[model samples]
Target: MKKQYKRFRLRTVSAMVAMAFVANAWAVDPFTVRDIRVEGLQRVEPGTIFASLPFRIGEQYNDEKGSAAIRALFGLGLFKDVRLEVNGDVLVVIVEERPTVADVEFAGSREFDKDVLKKALREIGLTEGRPYDQSLADRAEQELKRQYINKSLYGAEIVTTVTPIERNRVNLTFTVTEGEPARIKEIRVVGNKAFSESTLRGLFDLDTGGMLSWYTKSDRYSRAKLTADMEALRSYYLSRGYLEFRIDSTQVAISPNKQDITITVNVTEGERYVVSAVRLDGNYLGKEDEFKSLVTIKPGEAYNADKVAETTKAFNDYFGNFGYAFANVEARPEIDRANNRVAFVLVAEPSRRAYVRRVNIAGNNRTRDEVIRREFRQFEASWYDADKIKRSRDRVDRLGYFKEVNIETSDVPGAPDQVDLTITIVEKPTGSLQLGAGFSSAEKLALSFSVKQENAFGTGNYLGVEVNTSKYNRTIAFSSVNPYFTPDGVSRAVDVYYRTSRPYEDQGGNYQIATAGAGLRFGIPFSELDTVFFGGALERTEIKPGTNIPAAYLAYAERFGYKSVSVPLSIGWGRDDRDSAIAPTSGRYQRVAGEVGVAGDTRYVRSNYQLQQYIPLNKQFTLAFNGELGWGKGLGGQAFPVFKHFYSGGLGSVRGFDQGTLGPKDVTGSTIGGPKKITMNAEVITPFPGAGNDRSLRMFGFIDAGNVYGENEKFRLSELRASVGVGLSWISPIGPLRIAAAHPIRKFPGDRIQRMQFQIGTSF
Candidate 1:
């Protein structure tokens, strides 16, 4: 019965087609009232067109509706042709569909990446698995030609070949003629009043003669590079007080040979403007005084509109901290025509009270979404808090995974009532090696090396090995760190270190120490700019016998010596927004760490602290300062720890002084553990010539001062050893290299202070 039913259905369709054909054979007119029937459809059901058609069965057909129906079908790109036939009291429509593109394949596409070709085609609505028509194919060819032109191939041609295969599908190939990449022969900057032509040309990345120009291909007519040049021009004018600068025109001339290009940029220099007055306008949430203080734009200050706008945003943020989630701030700049100045009026308004819709993170390909979302202080479906936004940016930046972090707020186009927040970031190399070598009088020669992979196997795991060997000391350490413990910024680390050192004067006498431990480190990002980490770990160590050991240390070892164990608890805080990890001038970096023994076979509480700051003086200059302090003590009859102590005055500490030999000593003059010490330095940093702006080849002038003392010895600042010196730092492929030369401002003959000393990769 089922088979018979199916046969009947087929016969019914065939008879309908036959009867319609017979009627059409009687000299049918193109347009007439008749029975309407559709043909030439297989994949697309008949009902789809039947529902879309304006005319019904036996209805009169006009040229307008017939044309409209044909246009609608063609618009779908699924049909090759749609024509109408009219017989007396009958109508028939016939169509032939264009083939669906089952797949897209590329051949000989190394010169132009396959992805680039696919994207070009996709822009013209031609892609894999989509139906294609003649118009679309033609458009694809045009786009291909345009892409080749972008590569400076003026003579390039594109031939599209379509091949029909099985399954009513077709394959497409865009045979390309990739011409040689053109080079820029000359670049001219016109109508420039603020700076010289040479200066303006230097602002453009497209160099007329450069080795890298061939690779970056900026010499080609790149719209992106041209746009960047325009921006550079705008910035150069604004920084010099040009308030309304404009780019009038840009032109590129290709040679007849199609191998050389000449570029011309015309700019309009606007009049420089100055501040006339500063005014504050807008609703202040009963705290105008507080808001006014945060405003950096003063009446007498120069007209820096950017500063005024930033000040306004800061006011809105301040209100956000007070739970005013929808605080709005705007700055109004009023011009003083006679005085040639501008005034800024700051205003704020607290609008509808609302919470956050959802906090979403984007552009983290290697890291999991939960890994980033956990750092958010602002919860999903919670109030939109500016403070939380800033905090989230900071928190994400601190992950050490991103080189830049940017946040944007956008409204859903059709849904004006809804908003979406986007967090975009640029990933950077997290794993690094700290390798160094240098020569110094204090230690004769020195070398320090450390290998660290912060993101092991792209899984956010870290492994490290550190070795510091010199004439006076030798150390080897193996360690591993996980910044994400349970995927929420909870960190963990395991370390094992062994050291053997020869004391100064007793150059042949050696002492050995070893330590092994594992600990957890977690961060609490209380604010966008602040994070604190506190954790503990158990450790075991062995102190081997050696000569040149201080009598105090020897006696202590005899009493409670040889082998011991302990647990150390540590806490640290860090904030780094530096533009560069190795050499930064535009941002700030700060960190503090302290550790104390809590439990084990021995009892001790030891702590150390360090502070560093960087200030960018200019494009090629920076001012930096660093200070370090350490303290150690014994508890429960345990001996004063040797490894826990700090010895200052070296390449990484105070230059011009001997390493480990800077602090005080006993009768034998061995480097006995000092209870406390401090090192302070200030440096003016600059890029080294021949190395460009390489973080590895940095040079600086520095001032250093430090001293160590016994626990009972009075902390005397007046007796601090001060040295002024010049330092150099480099990130060589082998590792980081550092060198410093100093002349002690205050020194006694044979004071063990070296005129030259280096321990690699440290400045000031």
Candidate 2:
């Protein structure tokens, strides 16, 4: 429109000039003498035109300057074009304007969503019904293509189709084509020294074949997998004594098909060193002997960095126990190159003797922090006690509420001589219940039951009932434990029980006996994890002399009293840190109980002691050992108590033996009471998911060695009964279900058959 107006005005101006030229023959010099006049501009006001012109009215009307002024006015984007006319001292400027845009629209764009497509077009400044351009339309198509590529659509195509509409306008539609995503087809591992190809392949999440591979995203070539694979490789070597090793380089190669990936890791293996000696290097403030006592490493041993680190830690801890919160210990090594040995030099520095600023407990979701805090001996604003911190860790660990307990220390910010301790924990189920049923040979068609709530009602209290029934006799019991019996941390317990069972007779005969008892027990802490308990019980026992009953038992019972009522006082000491109540991997537990018939009218005093300890054979295996000793002697010419007699060859007592059919046999071939018995067992536990690390809820192979002899028989290791087998167990709501198919490795002649047994809830 602007160009057309310019042509029209040029014609008019030329015509006027031509006519003036004709009228001014021989007087051309007179044209510039008259006044200038303007015409044909509605918006281009005359005052605006004069302001735009470089020449004044009195100046020469040169065509170059006059035309330049008109071009400048049209370029303001305010005018479509400006026309100039020069007619005998008259200048005319005519302008035509362009139309404005109102709105823009899109249709059928689902691939890139409308908003994103709109943004793509806005980059080129195209929107609404704004003044459109062919250049912006072309650029918009390219911009949309770039966006699609980012979504992995390398084969994507974009087309912008413009439609002309009413009043010199058009509509633009960006059409796109999105292609399929590329999938990885294969993966390969390279440069493995510590393991085989199949082993290494098993370590990687990425794999070559399987229908479910796509769901697991195992076929995707990812840097994350590569990094994790490297770590796995590193751990495998480190665990095998390849400590000084490094992964030199790694390469990820994509196949020509672009769907397969191959990874290669190059590693460097360094020399393995042995520890020759350890010597302290730093000033111990003339207390070298005291610090030296903390060293635990042996001189002529393989280099165990862990032990050295532990020794240094012990030194630091000892300092902290004496109010030095910032004690530091560093282990420096001097290599004996010629002898292929390494010597360690220990250094200790006490940076500061600081006080405790705060002690915070964290990561306890179910247990209250106060419950744990009460166990601490270290107080805020008091001198930091490393010993207390360790004790605190032990206290929390002993609670059986966490899988791991860790303490993190940091200097109180802006406080030079203050420290804050954070106890971070990984909470576990402190409460456990096992409900199960099983059958055994000795206890034919037996049903074992137990209901124990370790953390009863979420308060860390305990209550339980346990019963084992057989054709012979059934025993029922009820027990309660208040972990925090008193505000001062003493523990209290109550137990009530009744048992009625026919004593299994071998040769003579079988008979029935019934017994009931009640007791109150109180515990005082000997240490954070140790406790001493004292209790008194009133027990009544009635013995029905059987034809199979050992002559000695009957003879003694006749003198003790047909139905005896006795009150007994018992004292016991227990300390347990094993990870589990039934089975432990890395912890130890001990129990010793003895009772004397002080208050009871019985003529005998009876006592028993059982000690158990657990040690980890590996991350997945635990070794457990146990021993038992018991004795009952006549008092005031009276007989021993029948209910407290020792019985063995059961699920908990012996793996392959039948329940309650073990002990000293009567003269009539009945296995009767024994004055004492001893037992031992070893187990290897493995994991089965859906169950936590409760030893009772795992699959394991075990070797049990022990036997129950007569009460008067001497304990000897050579006479121990040994049983070996694989067992399966899991926690049920009623009790632990443990089924072991065992073979008695060593059994005496005429011993009862105990090939396989299923026992629910047995503790060793």
State every prediction's TM-score relative to the real structure.
Answer: 0.64, 0.62
Tens digits of per-residue lDDT for model 1, 1-764: 11111001111124324433433343223344546677887667788777767788756665556555655665565776566555445556676767887666665444688888898788778998788767788998888778777777776767778999777688988777666777778888888887899877766656575443443455666778778777776777765666667888899888898888888888887677776666666677677888778877666655665676678778878887765665677776676666667776666677644555656677777766665676677776665677888888777776778878888876556644445677887778877777777655555567888888776765767788989887766778888776666544556666676666544443565666656565666666555556788888777777767765576566656676667788888888887666777666666667777777778776677767777778887556789888888777778776567656667667777778776666667666566648688888899988664333334467889888888878677778876888897877767665466788998886544457677776545544
Tens digit of per-residue lDDT, candidate 2, span 467-585: 87777768899999887878778888999999887555433355567789999989999777788999898888888765556665676577666587888888988887767675557
- On lDDT, the leading prediction is 1
Q: After superposition, how far is residue 616 of candidate 1 from its true place, in Å?
A: 2.2
Clashes of 2: 23
Candidate 1, residue 500: how far the Cα is off, in Å = 5.4
Top candidate when judged by TM-score against the true structure: 1
Alpha-carbon deviation at 65 in model 2, angstroms = 48
